[model samples]
Target chain A: MKLIYRHLGAIKIVALLAFMVFVCLPLVQMTLLAFVATLPHEELEVGQATLQNFSGILTDPNLRAAFGNSIAYVLINICITIPVALPAAYAFSRMSFVGDKSLFLAFIAFRITPPVVLTLPVFQLFSALGIVNSVFGIALAHCLFNLPISIWILQGFISAIPREMDETAFIDGYSRPRFIWSILIPQIRAGIAVAAFFCFMFSWVEVVFARILTTTNGKPISMAINALFGFQTDIGLVMAVTLASMAPGAVLLFAMRNHLSRGFRIGQV
Target chain B: MKTKDNSGWIFVLPAMAVLGLIGLIPLVTVVNYSFFEIFILSSRFWVGLEWYGELVGSARFWQSFARSSLFSMIILLIQIPLGIALALCIPRGRIWIGLSLVVVALPLLVPWNMIPTLWLSLLNPETGLLGRLGVVLGWPLDWKDSAVHTWVVIVMMDVWHWTSLVVILCYSALTTIPAAYYQAAAIDGATPWDVFRFIQLPRLQNVLLMAVLLRFMDSFMIYTEAFPINAGGPAEATLFLAVDLGEEIKAFNYGPSAARSVLYFLIIVTVAWLFTKAQGKLEEKAAP
Candidate 1:
């Protein structure tokens, strides 16, 4: 029985490793494709890898603008979302006001509404405001979805903190703002990190709004990548840009892996 | 436990304002536009529910709706079970735990637009590793001509992209389970299945419900990945609801598109409501 159990354990490990390889295969292919100076039609040869694709893509004006725009708008979206969500989430966790339940439900409803449904209306709305193809516009547009989710996740995180913490802080003569800044914030730093990571991820990866809301001026990396899909672009250059797009998210995930794992348990993300 | 503090309104006001300006206004505008015959954004004639009527009577709308529902169902069926199994199989050591978590999250971090492109390159028969392997295995991996192959690829891509979400959630829930329960089960000579069935599954109910809700919503809204893959090709076999809506918008058919949008929103809201109700009932039943 012991021997059989040990063998089963070995089998499980082998299966997991196989699964990991399967999951990573496409990514590995894309990375390799980015490096090699081979077209989709040409056969890949060993040791033919070159850095030209990377240099070629990085030097392209449109691709460079897209990279900058993507980073800018994602950061802007995170900035707009977190501060607003923090107070609202605090309220939901600690206090009850009129229509609070209904308001909360409405937020969830907004989160559920498909971005495609809002695409046309948002395009029209932004056009009227003369903010179409602007980074601020896309950032605001993203808040339509990101804010609710951030609030929801932060509310979960805040509620998990003991009520006594708040009570004790008040008794110790810490002003509300000071208490939030110094005491409450530090306690839920992991939650904030997770929430910020999610906001950044969603805004960075979202393509629908980015596609419709911006045309040329603030075209995001996703839109640029999609444009390449339309024309007969070189596969190597496309792969390089795609790989570059994954870098920010990869860095964020690695940096906050611990907070993310913890946040999953507490924030229900 | 409720605190009677209307002062909370002050806290919620900024978010509410932003949400109202950005979210609710557009939503209301979409509903309003559904009732008009819109030639353009600024030019419209009052049509009074004609678009909605047309949408309801349209065969394409029904087809896309059914397609979307089927896709979401398949995603849930595969990802949930596979996620649970993988979560169970994850090695319980410090380095293994950290490595697995990061590896699982890698796919989720890739931008939505790049996902289809990545898969396309990987499945390209001439150059892709999978394609070459398929050739060796004598399997027809053509996505262009075979609807079945297209569907298989879409499902495979989705499972690969999203199973990590389920794994993470379930793994976290598993971690919260006390070791005492497992020890008791072992002492009682319980089978591995018995230990899982009694202890882990019960503890997993809440997180699993959450996982189901999220996976359903995300999959239902899937467009960025599916569209770039085949653009609802192979005779429109993969033309899900969002892709269908996108076509209308692309053609600048604002009226019918708005109606479709409203209907799509309603379907999502209703299904989500039903899920929440079901979850509440389950919790009530589970509680002593």
Candidate 2:
């Protein structure tokens, strides 16, 4: 107890308090605003807390469909990103191909490519393909950018695992698919979890491409939340929608706060 | 180290192909469009760097560029050191460790758009804490109209939104340091300040560099929040490069927009490269 207090006494108290305030402020504001009725001038009425806002959002078919679209897109994004990413990660981690380093860098380069910049070309192409305003279109758009990051991060994790595992699996008569699914995967389970979480998070919260690609039927929660902006601002509904959109991520992060911190700490590598 | 399949390309080919068609191909198309003059349906001519020249010559583009750099710089100035300080404050063990991490991790889970909205209301003079306090203190604080205030709001919004990233990164890096090193520092009679300077700061170099680069890139490319608040209002004062490029894309001025994007891409790539190079040197010096 003396040892702990000696080192952490003053500094720990200050940091812990500040950090709690910092983390809690926005969330508390968001949660509170989402529940109450708006005052006359776009403000939350101090005494008007209710679950009516949640009911208002849930009952709206458009909001429901938007929720559906978001879920579908997130799932599709994970499916696309993980399968392709796993193989590409393995290749980059293990293979000696021409321009492998350059190719990997190129993938990293795409991760940094601004969606605002890429929006035009994708808009043009998807418009031509008649896939604009579709869930698949948004999924494709996300997968394009996110695939590289998945490879980069997953490659790092995959590389850290021993190669002998693969050899041993093969020698035990495991096929390539079986070896990967049975042996290689379990070794990098944490990596897969981290990578998949990020992939889902990015796809879930991504605005620009999702906005650009989907028109009505496939509109995501981010875009839908933006649509809450009426001429006379309904701060309550807007806050409710925004809070609803952010809830899953907030909950997930809270639940897996340690993993999330470690993932960020390690540079997602 | 999985070498059972030399045909790993077979697995990767599908993904690379899709990414190429959607991601890389469009970029190539953007580059191609930048170099050509296109008219309705049937007119195409080699413009040969004309769009690039126009982009460079435009005062608007330069203004937006300057704004972007300024925003990124201010965010870095505030977030990096603040993050380090916050990381330094947290107690290092399992119980408080879990609680401390959960505390810092909260801000990051909020979506980008909600951040500005929350602040916009929180600083509203009627019901907002900041706004009501400002009124009581007799300082007429208006976040929307004044350019300097807009900068403050944006900076605050960014700091609120992103500092968690830095804190988490630094804390993660800090936790990985072996306990014996710190114990040794203490045994050597190192003060808390001395231990942090000599040990913690050195260990944090790589993660700090990563934090800086991520923050710079994200802040520089900021669009959604800035657009919603002032909509680049009050004579384009808050019109960062993203807003300017957004306008071009909105107008369907494909040629010039593509050119500007290419230029933007090159500039960022250059800055990131230089940053990484400097970080490499720092990492070398800080090496144990």
Which candidate leads in lDDT? 1
Give the fraction of reference interface contacts each candidate recovers.
0.70, 0.47
Q: Which stretches of candidate 1 lie above 4 Å from their native place?
A: A1-8, A39-47, A97-99, A267-269, B1-4, B141-143, B178-190
Assess the local accuracy of residue A131 in candidate 1 as a C-alpha lDDT between 0 and 100. 91
lDDT of 2 by residue, B1-288 (tens): 224444766766876787897888788888888887776425778898999999889887888889899999999999999899888777756667677766676566555666678887777787676678779987566556678877777887788878877887798678767889989997998877788888888778767876787788888999987777777865788888888788888887878888888888888778878887897787677664
A1-269: candidate 1 lDDT, tens digit per residue: 65756586787788778779979999999998889876543464533787777887768888999999998998898899999999898888888888888888778778877889999888888999999999989999999878987887788688878899888999999976688789888888888888888898778888889988888689998888777764566777788888888888888888876666555554332
Which residue pairs of candidate 2 clash?
Answer: none
Backbone clash pairs for candidate 1 read none
lDDT of each: 0.84, 0.77
Mark the 10 consecutive residues where model 1 chain B has the least summed lDDT: B138-147
| Cα lDDT, model 2, residue A176 | 74
Query: Comparing to the true complex, what docking class would candidate 2 get?
Result: acceptable
